[model samples]
Target: MKWPILQAFPSFSPRYLRPFLRLCAQQSALIIGKKLHALILTTGLSATQTSFLLNTLLHFYASCGDILSAQKLFVEIPHSCKDIADWTALMSSFSRQNRPHDALRLFAQMLENSIQIDDVPMVCLFSVCAWLRDVGVGSQGHGCVVKMGFEGKVKVSNAMMDMYGKCGMVREMRRVFDEMKEKNVVSWTVVLDGVLKWEGVRSGRLLFDEMPERNEVAWTIMVVGCVGSGFSKDGFLLLSEMVFHWGFKLNHITLCSLLSACAQSGDVVMGRWVHVYGLKLMGTEMDIMVGTATLDMYAKCGRVDTAVKVFECMPRRNVVSWNAMLSGLAMHGRGRVALDMFPRMIEEVKPDDLTFIAVLSACSHSGLIDQGSYYFDNLESLYGITPKIDHYACMVDLLGRAGRLEDAQTLINQMPIPPNEVVLGSLLGSCNSHGKLQLAERVLQKLTEMNPLNTEYHILLSNMYALAGKRQKANSLRKVLTTKGIRKVPGMSSIHVDGHVHQFSAGDKSHPRTQEIYLMLDDMVRRLRSAGYIPNPASQVFSGSDGIEDDAMDLEEKEQALFSHSEKLAVCFGLLSTKPGTPLYIFKNLRICQDCHAALKIVSKIYYREIVVRDRNRFHCFKQGSCSCCDFW
Candidate 1:
């Protein structure tokens, strides 16, 4: 398709070239742009005309993601003709390309050339600073903002706050917020977000209450932040206020954020409500973001069948959408189904890094070693994705879980990049599972060398010792930990009931209905015993069990420790509170113990109730005396 101007190139006016160049840049018509550049050179335009056109030409290349061309053209532009826009455009291109160091270098050159800084360039500089997380450079930019009298600009001020917040300079961010003479919704929201990151949900809520105006973004931030930090009740209340009280319409991002929060908190009631609301708001057509988020919420909340329905109904799908479905299946221990979906995914949208991570994890969870090995071996050759640490971690986990400890170790040693905590941790977990005490010790030594202050690794090894009947070694380790003032992080579990989340620790008595909870637990134990539920001896020695002493324990004491584990307490409370046949959703901060897992299997059958537990690793759905994982997990 030839443009009319190209047919009559000789008669083309310089003014005509400006709009054509502008259009080419707008649409990123690179070939058309190259022809126009040739025409400009051949037409022999005057110096001033060419100079003006050069700025637009430079921007065209930048807009098309041709950083090299943009840089070359920037160099070609005469110093006298170059302005702040040209400098800013090139710097922005570098920033967009994730070359923040290059952007900083250009900024320095612009400063050397005596180019005046404006709000736009300063904002770009702050973004680069944020990406670099360089507070020294960011502080210098703040000084420049003050020096240049651009401090009053809202966008500039917001960028500064964002940079500071991302760099963990929360106090500086707050100071900037306090000193601002004028504040808008974004201003309040930025400060609120920073406060949430540094000071936790309670402080964020306090700041949110004080805001003069609340928009959807501010509400979303507060809601997601609260739910993410284990404050589900407050998060739900905030959502209610945002909708019913303020009558604010929820956008897809807001809906997605809320759904993700619901997933994190395992609040199925809220998740279902959000799904229905999204359906109504967006009509029958489900876009990718909302659909994927809704699917993830269901999957995380232990409803993979519903997630599959949502996945099938989505009007559009991307790699992320496919990954969500695959991950959902993986979470439910449906590895073959997840693998089957992978072929179908690549038939439509191309798979990415996260997609492989989900697939490999599925294989690992289901003990599909052959399939996992094939995919991992061909990741680079077949998919053009160089295996990252996460991929290696998944492979390690796969081999380790299958009792191929030597093979897993060999793979880790052969990895190009060093194994991260997750990779080594996977191997450590596998070693413990297989009772390879010597191998577990070696892995623990490597883990401790990598992160000496990581208490979880120490506790894992201690639990192994206790389980192996080496009580002296376990007691010594516990004493050393206590002497060093490093207390083990207690396990916590929460269940959503009647729109309120009830949190419990082992032996927790904090609930108002504590007496009833204990009585219900006593009944559960009796019923479980009648149903032939014996506490796992391994579960008894888990190091973080609350109220358990470091001293050697008798068999009766060990069994006592097992009964009061956090998930059991939460389950007992759920049973006591909810009606008969009501499904219970439990979210735990740690993995479900062996005793809880076995007991919950019996509890589901005896009580005629379905129990879904989402622990740190994956989802477990118990029904009719069987678990969704089929005892693999």
Candidate 2:
């Protein structure tokens, strides 16, 4: 298919050869392009009158994706022969390769030398600005565009809106969009994306419905935008709308967004749907991103077995894929298995900061205090990765949970970065669990000073006072919270049945089946008593004080408090609704109190069921009157 342009023109005339080189450049013919570069250098055509021949060669190299060759030629170009196009060609090449830092440096050099750029190449500069979110440089580019009179160009204006949006100046983006004389689909999409970033999905949806025409990218962006904005349920609906009503085919981006929504909401049914949709669309050609997201979805939804299947069957695994599996195991309290994967991970793939975090978290949850310490010590020395705040948080939790509070405090004091709320919170939680009130008081003092608005720490301190029989101190703190309008966040629990998520709270009787659920609870209590499950009376009084009255009033109060706990209600509902001995999974918004954890262990043994519960901090798997955490959690 190679054309003989030079053979036809043996004299190598400028007119004939120039036309032939331009054709080869447009075709991006690398071999012919190289021959033409050699011809120009040997004949000294570039030095005779102009460097149009050299510039054409530059375009040819760049267009063929030979960025290194194009950069070399541009560097060798004579100062007199170089023009705006020559500068733009090299800049565009770097920008297209995602080397924005290099691209911007070249732009700065162009400005220093006063090389004029037309509107077309200005798009590349604006794109780099958008991606980097460099407001100062972008404003300078905007000023230059004004001076050069490219203000009315649609592509330039679109890029400007994108840059402004990424810089968090949504008002300026809207102004540019309003001022533009002509607007295209890209302009609308950019504004829509900006709205999603600045606000929520509702605003973006309004703009999307108002658009004159929508392309595939615009539709996909809208769907992903909802997931990113934390309106994951809305994201799922939009995906359905796109496929069913708009007749848009499901792409990798759309599927990944949907999987994220499924994970956030813990909607296993919808996750299965997305999984099926992926198989239907790709049919043996699974995208690694889609597969990794699927693994994440299953793991977060408490189906670790399914996640393992997906991980094993994946055609390929990247670092992210391995991290997802490790995180999944850590989250679901399979810390032993999670730790087992580490040596294999080191053999095959390199572990980063996130990998160590997952490893430390697994060790913390499983009471592998020694293993957690080993990883924390070797994090920098063995892995050559600096320990971030999350890794430090896991270590603090590890030491504090193992009753090494002094070591935990020393680690915090020795942290390279200032200890944040999470590190302090982990220590405080361990303090509350192990009855270390003095350290709790000190941590609370620092926390309250750091964030006066945070009532959770205040509540924790108050609860500690209540537990220690300092009722006046607890009452005084409660009065101050009421005065500051800081009400405690009520704990909530939810269980997924079929596709619907049912919620329960302390004393919650809002469900239509409340009567049936309560009746089921009564039956469960009768059976539990027969099987030697007596309620722990200490749970009723916030104070763990000695000498409880066995009077009728005291007994009634204890019974009412124990029965209305949110997790108990959710568990009773699951027991009644599902088949016998079926595995039940529940998610709780707060840490599982000691009484609830104790009650669930007995319930599991009596009912012959396995219950997987995820509380605020970690997972608890109850079966046969035993918990996976072995009373350490």
Candidate 3:
């Protein structure tokens, strides 16, 4: 196959070298690339071959993420003689460097020079548009694809679908996907991710169920969606089915998502198993993402020591690693330790906005008002990160908890953006705690005006009126709510026993064990009373009544009504079903009513056991006649 010319010179001409170098660059072979460069220099073809060889080198460097070298070589290529591939290569390099704006500028320059658009440039532009969420620019690129008769190309169409999805145009993404003559796994994964990120887990699950063929990516996407959307149980359930029933091999991605689900659900036992399996499967060379997920899992599962061990064992640490450890410490009420890690984080990884948010959250939970305030105020100055709405909300919570209601209000008013429902809700709760009736009323009024359909604000206002001894006002509010068909939300509680969840609502007698629960509650009350516990009648004034009735029958009815709150029944059920010295864990869907809180304190002392109850807003660990919330929540 040897040619006569190659036999004569024993080598190809520099003119022939161009195509060879271009091919080597396209294939991304460093060995062939260096050999080509040396051959050009040995032939004394520097002046003649510099431009083409440099362009080839630039392409190789850009593809390998050596952007500095690529940029230096690109600067040597004269703009007047640059080809389409050179322009495309530079745009792609900038895009990979996270400089989308620079890529767009280069695209504009290429267009001005009348360079014909190709699939590579179109994909690069679409990628930039996706990153910037610039739908208009993306549509313009689509038009170019159509005009160039490249609309039938699968790769180009996939890029378009990805652009629409990342820009949150789910309907458009589906339209493009539906129009495709054939669909691949990538097409399905991208659209599914869009649905999960924008619509929710239910939508993603629906799409997944309808999919004819499933791959590992499809399973991972669904699992991640479930965990992210607060349906961690569903995620774990799916993971179990995939492994045992579907016979899918678990990979790093699968294990990572499952670990996140366990962390979020606070399933420490399952998390430990996942950790063991991950070590056996991945062989301890865990990526940063998997390490972070495991650390977060341990922290949320109330095992800060385990989280610390994972963090220490990680081969490399990033900002997310530090944030995970700090967040775990904060969740476990080890705020001092979380704060102590801040300096180390800055020294190691240079904390970012999310890092600050985690640290600030720890401070807020620990009631370190001054520390939280300091970090919040200096976020922009110290880290060049502006405080977002969540940060402001945490600040409001911190100030509100410290009983500095006026200061919190002032801060809310001074915020660059208007306060959202969370900020207002935090303020209202603080007012209720401090008995600041007037301020509570004002905040409620504003909240109702902003969101008239919100039932929670109406309930809060009604309770505020009752606490202020304004029965007429409370009654009027209740009447309005009744007319609007807005009944108060029923209080419900659940306790896990023998791996099954048992739920109860206020005044509920539907459980099969109802009679036994009632009997147990009665006996517990007697034991608590004998231990010098007195009923806190102050919480019985639902209608602002003194609860001391003129008639004995009316007093008896009031006492009966107070005993039927859902938390009380759940506590009773826990006492009867669980053994002695076992800590009872109850989850309530609302704030623990004042009566329930006092009763539980007495129950804890009388039974000589600790009861941990997590309510809507805070945790109440009642032991020895005291609560961790200090009777404040």
Clashes of each: 0, 0, 0
Q: Summarize candidate 3's per-residue lDDT along 181-256 as a digit string, tens digits.
A: 8877777888888889899989899998888788887887887677666565676687778778888887777778
Instruction: State how far residue 376 of model 2 sits from its true place (Å).
Output: 2.2
Off by over 4 Å in 2: 1-211, 216-241, 244-246, 283-285, 486-490, 521-562, 572-581, 606-609
Give candidate 1 misplaced runs (Cα > 4 Å): 4-50, 60-72, 75-83, 94-119, 128-150, 230-234, 543-549, 552-554
TM-score of 3: 0.67
Ranking by lDDT: 1, 2, 3
Best-matching candidate per TM-score: 1
- Checking candidate 1 for backbone clashes, the offending pairs are none
Index of the highest-lDDT prediction: 1
Using all chains and alpha carbons, the TM-scores for the candidates as numbered come to: 0.90, 0.72, 0.67
Error in Å for residue 352 of model 2? 1.2
RMSD values for the candidates in order, in angstroms, are 3.2, 7.2, 8.2
Who is ahead in lDDT, 1 or 3?
1
State how far residue 502 of model 3 sits from its true place (Å): 4.5
Tens digit per residue, CA lDDT, model 2, 368-446? 8888899889888999999899999999999998889999999999999999999998899889878899899999989
